[model samples]
Target: MSTHRPLRIVFAGTPEFAADHLAALLNSDHEVVAVYTQPDRKAGRGKKLQPSAVKQLALEHAIAVEQPEKLNTALAQQQLAEYRPDVMVVVAYGLLLPEPILTTPKYGCINVHGSLLPRWRGAAPIQRSIWAGDEASGVAVMQMEKGLDTGPVLHVERCAIDAQETSASLYKKLAQLGPRALVTTLDDIESYRERAEVQNHDAATYAKKLSKDEGKIDWSDATQLERNVRAFNPWPFAWFELPGGKPGQRTVKVHQASVSQTDHRSAPGTIIDCSPAGITVACSQGALTLHSLQLPGKKPLPVSDLLNGYATTFAIGVNLTNVD
Candidate 1:
């Protein structure tokens, strides 16, 4: 049992990352007085309404849920003020807290950010870290302030980035790491506040939200292409284009890949070998072994599986390019 009195916390988050932290708070000594999440969104092929991960979890726990479109509104401000929260715990909450909301809580608002502060400090830290080929990435608990993620750090927990780690996988790791850091910081909030240090703004690099165009592979640099394979998985996944007979291009999504040691002078994107080993495409610097891939409107399959059926598409001498 905890010796300290429970802190009154107002939790704000939207995605699974944020929801996981909320879950941690629910299991901890702190009392999450209320939960705030983004409004329901239309998702999937059916385009049906779906509540955010945080909203779903908050409903399950019977916590009072708030889904104001914007917190800056007078009504929204009044609604939160009623909670009289001691502190606000924010994770991947999409909306920025206004000055009113930020100042409402006694201790202000604190965030469970995805990266070690003063590094990748924007909307998409997990993907950016892996895209930059960072050896390690971690979570940071910080006293939230105005600038992007430019808050003073309270606590940080680093984790090694595996050789083949993807955004989907690394995100899960950080999601689990973030809550523990928040819990420890909340355990003794004052000490962390006093110990926090201002971030070096000069060293800060923003990790902008990814786009589908960024997933196009540039095979000139094996290293960069390899990083793209891992960094973009599960969203804007690394992709290439194959000419479809007479006209149009067949889009293929790379599911899993690795840097190959095959020494080749062929032009980038040239299919030099395709066998049970994998589909080896000669790049400008080296080669890429595509183990798994997804043809448009088809399920992900290993190269061996494709060889048995789509052999013509993976045939040697074929060039996969983004151009028509």
Candidate 2:
């Protein structure tokens, strides 16, 4: 939409979320000179090397693709120079763009970050937002800089967070919202860039990456357990380890849960009830109704479906509180 000449953009990103934006750019009028994505890596049980979603989409468009392990390297920087890009678009690129690469293009680099500036600035912003029980979360398009997600914001788009919204749901929402905002910001690039708002560093909070260990449900707080059940879904799902199982230990993944107020004096982790509704596990303050779950190497299923097969799994009075 800029009145200036059409831009030669260098697109850098890796994940499916990033690919969505690149897909939109390809449909736009601008020319994407090159695509930069992480090299294919092993995935799934078979561990076959998998190209990133962005790479797959780029190849389909017949765009040039580069998978440089290190963009800070002189060779990588020079290769970027050869393209003579007017600007670069980066989203969930994983690899950090050193200052040299950030400042290379005439219009500099633009980033579509998951959360609003000065909040959840680091990795795992979407998951952090859900874990924090935030009422709302959104995307921010910023002019890239050396610091992590600290660049000034050129445009922002916000949406309410549903009470039951999980990391997966919020991620998809932001992915769709980001590209639209990015396109609008680019319509009048220089004007928006010149008026970009500098972030308030003092108010910043880092969204530390989610970890499998953290997915171990802590039943001390029923509310937190419910949130974790939502926050950790689709990856490192909220799980617990029972001390005595077929193998002396078994890990159970909690896919869907809700905080319950059922009166129960039993200690935390006790299976207070297992009905068609769910398996209610007593917590410190209240109880958690686990609606859906999955055993190792098994598909997720509702409690009703699971009860038909493993009725013994949620036997009343059995302690389900072990964290691993």
Model 2, runs deviating above 4 Å: 1-5, 246-249, 322-324
TM-score of each: 0.95, 0.95
**Residues 2-100, candidate 1, lDDT per residue (tens digit)?**
335689999999998888999999999999999999999999999999999999999999999998889889999999999999999998888988888
Question: What would the per-residue lDDT of candidate 2 be over residues 96-128, giving only the tens digit for each residue?
Answer: 899889889999999999998789999899999
Note the clash tally of each candidate. Answer: 0, 0
Pairs clashing within candidate 1:
none
lDDT of 1 at 35: 96
